[model samples]
Target: MPVSLWAMEPMMPLADMPAMVLTPARVSQPQSEAPASVTVIDRNLIEASGARELYEVLKLVPGMTAIKVDGNVPTVAYHGTQARDSRRMLVLLDGRSQYQPGLSRVNWNDMPVDIRDVERIEVTRGPAAAAYGANAFTAVVNIITRDPRDISKHTVSVRGGNNGILDGRAAAVGHGDNTAWRASVSRRADDGYDEPFEGETRPDRKRIETLNTEWVWESDSHNTFALQVGGSQSRLERQQESGVADIGRYTREPVQKGERAFLGLEWQHVFSATHQLKISTYGQYNKEVTDFGVCYLDPFTGQQGPGGALLFSQELRELYSQNGGDTAATFAAVPTSGPVLSRYGSLQGVAGVNFCADSELDLQEERYDLEVQDTWQINDRMRLVSGANVRHDRVSSQAYLSGTEDNVSYRLFGNLAVDVLSPLTLNLGGYWERDQINGEHFSPRGGVSWRVAPGHTLRYVYSRAVRTPDIYEDQAITNIQALDMSEPFASNPEALLGWSPSYFFITQSSPGTLKPEKIRSEEIGYYGQFRFLELDVRYFQEELTDLLSHALNPFEFEPNNEGWVKHQGTEAQLTFRPTVNHLLRLTGAHIHTHTNKKTETRIAARDSGSALWAWQLASQWGVSTAYYFANDYNDYRYERADLQIRFRHRAGPAELEWRAVIQHALNKEPIVFEENQYQEDRMWLELEMKI
Candidate 1:
């Protein structure tokens, strides 16, 4: 294939490169001088990879795991602790948090910004509590978008491909003497995987719309102000089953709708060469609604019952009838039947008769945050960065919580850096935080970086991080309301009249409130830049305690902090660029975990690696290929390859670019979410024009 001339764009020289990190220290420091391990993915790599989604780009980061259970639902795990609701890591969009307090999960499908608007992504692959308070237990991801000044003209993009994928986006930027503004709108839809697991329904289908706008004003070099606003709406198809006994049936084609909006303002001022200050405020609102329904059979007679009713055993039904709706006695009575009732029954039952009640888990949350920070250059060798913030969260849910709940939190953090000697630097940082639900706690971090040689640097770091219990875990109220049996069995009172007329509630609450999960970590890292290669290697060990897990008592299933886990890992990344048009990148990680509970081991991969090759055949065309592999785990194992080809041309006043990407080129099927779904090969083509 012939490559385009643009594909031969010169790479930035390593010597002149400045520190591009943002999340590690909340300050721009040279990559070699940063205390923590950081990975930066720039726009050039993003464009060359031909990736259409944000999660796909994260695969390049060492020790980071990106799992897409379906097209619309994706989870990213750092340091080997993943779950259905991943809450250990914090994600930020241009410094604004995307974490939802109600669910404690990041809704990747509903993010306001499209992939085309993103300029770079910074990932800190370790505990970040010292910089960002609680919930930064494992790692942090910060996404930075292109500034108005960086957008030279208007652009439009359109993409279409297999599996019903279609996407469209339009962006425009305007500049003035003292101000600049940017606005963008995007719409995307995909059919997802065509084939679902046997007896299961397809879940990856999705449609989403988003809008984003930003304005900035630079009065002078001393002062600057910026404002940003974004909103998104998404509709996704999911397959979920009920957890209730005898009622666990697959819900095919269940649709979930989400709406989100955010507004932010930032101001910075330079008092002098020695002192600078910045203040930022942001507010976010999100609401999700899904019509979740299930079907079940009556436990006693093994006959299909009403779709939405909560049915009990024959003995409990008789007890309720005799006791006149006494929930205590009704629950105390044990089943005398020989066989145990199955939570998930066969799907062959009749529809209307086996239909359970129509229920919905509707969650709505609002958050407001304000923070101010100062950067002081104490002297030529010493610097200090300090900040404090206040946050308030309001959550309302019908299925998860009692009612509207309010949580207020406050945090104070500071970091000090000192150059003790010519080639050695020391950093110390800590954060103190207090919240209405979790009380008060403190986390600390310390590190030292040494320039062992002209091209090599070594770093040793120690840190502690915490993960606070989320709203659902701390105050969940699972209500199972029984349907009225009076009318159905009025003719035969003895058979059905004994059933309870009220609801059965399963509530999880702790008298002392659950303690936050805590982890202490120690790491040693080496970074080196050679004539044709750049290498980064790190070894880390972490001890985690007070982890949250469900109580073992059969009578109740509340959450408790009674888990201990230890993890040790080694990760490395190697980038070899022999010439301007040829490049090779290799990344690998090996992790071992010991846990008091056996289930935790399934969350992380034991070994994983990827090898990528890119080449510019000619000026107008380019090609890239990659192979990714992961050791077999309990749930899944995969080895897949990908290919991308790009073409570019000039059309009068507009520039046109086209790219085609093939994922899972070998057509391998990978199981995800306990074999409920399988990921299949896919192909997509994108065309973009800039004027």
Candidate 2:
């Protein structure tokens, strides 16, 4: 994988703050009524936790691990799977998809909305393919922004802290009796780690700027219209930390930069008190330019063969294809060790000085989606929701795909819930989707919920889901077109014959070869609501097959789907809010993974938990303390504690709010990896005003 594919921070520790969610079954219903386990973080929880990024707040959810892959790019994975190329989950921003199909990843920093603008976040901690089709294999993260009518007239927020952290946001709202609109702009920057664990002065830094706006109009009781427009630009310093290619490498300025924009419109019509229809469409565009100069020595974390040969060269692959998998003839054509080294020089033959590859992971992706959904309350005991959507995705990447490719996907999904008996309810849903590349698939989900008592319920759910391979995974041609050599090779380029060519190509583009990742999940859950406390607990077992992975050695790297893995876990979340002045929240999960290879556990966590306690000391003062624990990624334990204080004051008609937070790592020395080690402590202070 290119360095740009390098895909959270100390968890801004979850308060069970929301009682209703709209993600589980695509309807606004009490959390207890949803078919899946749901966790919600409200704006109040966001304020008390002092979380500046979306992924930071996600640590509150059970069975979810949010971390920075290289202490720069934000990655949030449920039941942690391969994180560097985090896939299998679906992310939505106000009903619009935030995932890039081109890379099959989420650029959380480049998202237009700021943390302050988010009203609430709901996570469905299970497969949602029955409702969202493919790519909802593990979970769904739904971010709901503050409604235009609910935004304050004017708001400003600013924060600065250690590690070169600086952030600022400004928002304005304009509204009348019939219409409301909101506009906001924000900027954030951070200078990562003083120094890396292994290497000193690592080039790791990030900056992002965003502009967002929304407009809503109520055209009478039966009709409503909404429009949204947003854009963001981001810059990140990329550092390739490991392998011979990266060792002793000097720092470079900004290595990657990206810009993205989106436009959306929606119309809702209410035919009756119990029936409604919604039609929505959105268009999104994103472009990224990346630059890196590195030698092709060793790419994978684990070295292979004798000196980690660069055998997966495009020339050898082409020769192999041309010779019909005749390895003898193929190698004969592109000899590994000859006078000229044939097409690709042997790893033992090429020294560091004779190799230079102008590597770029540049790409542009565009997506358009249109959806129509209808909901009907057939009776007091029956509810039905159904929807259909079509998505068109276009990706252009000369380095990744070698050309432009477009695919159209169509999906039809529906969910029905009926009270079969006085205390039992049944939920049945399915999704049928057809994609140009992934073909057609139908996933079904069935669940039953029994209301044990007035405030308690039990649920059993079963679902089947799939994750289609991304464009880069299916049709990848990773290479550098321009090859620049130094010294000896520059003086006598022809002496090497046609070994290096004009450039060194990594993989020959292969389309329609890899299969989709598939999963089957079974869960038993319980929810209880009382006057003083609430509880949500779940036990789940997931079996995944045809997983996508490849060896790091370019010569041996071939995307294949034959792996099998199973994960079983229990997740629980509890909230104790006896009074409005005090609150206590706890969340935890324990998982055991059985993979084809035991050494592959680095992508999954064995145990994770968090606790938070808050007190309203006075009318204008409040304090909160949070702690997080997670371990078992190569047996590395991560522990962190957070303490925060909030203050508010009145200035004429405006209100001034202040927040200060301190986070410290509790682990003396936990080894996540050899190259990237997190700082021991981080701190920040924030000021916000509303007029």
**Top lDDT model:** 2
- C-alpha lDDT of candidate 2 relative to the true structure: 0.78
In TM-score terms, candidate 1 sits at 0.89
CA-RMSD of model 1: 5.2
TM-score on alpha carbons, each prediction: 0.89, 0.88
lDDT of model 1 at position 95: 90
Q: Please give, for residues 41-113, the per-residue lDDT of candidate 2 as tens digits.
A: 8777776666778789888998888877666787788988775767778999999988898988888878888
The candidate scoring highest on TM-score is 1
The runs of at least 3 residues in candidate 1 whose Cα sits more than 4 Å from the true structure, single-residue gaps closed, are: 1-9, 242-245, 248-253, 306-356, 480-512, 550-558, 665-669, 672-679
In order, candidate lDDTs are 0.75, 0.78
Worst 10 residues of 2 by lDDT: 1-10
In the predicted model 2, the residue pairs found to clash are 8-67, 8-68, 14-60, 311-555, 312-555
**Model 2 vs. true fold: TM:** 0.88
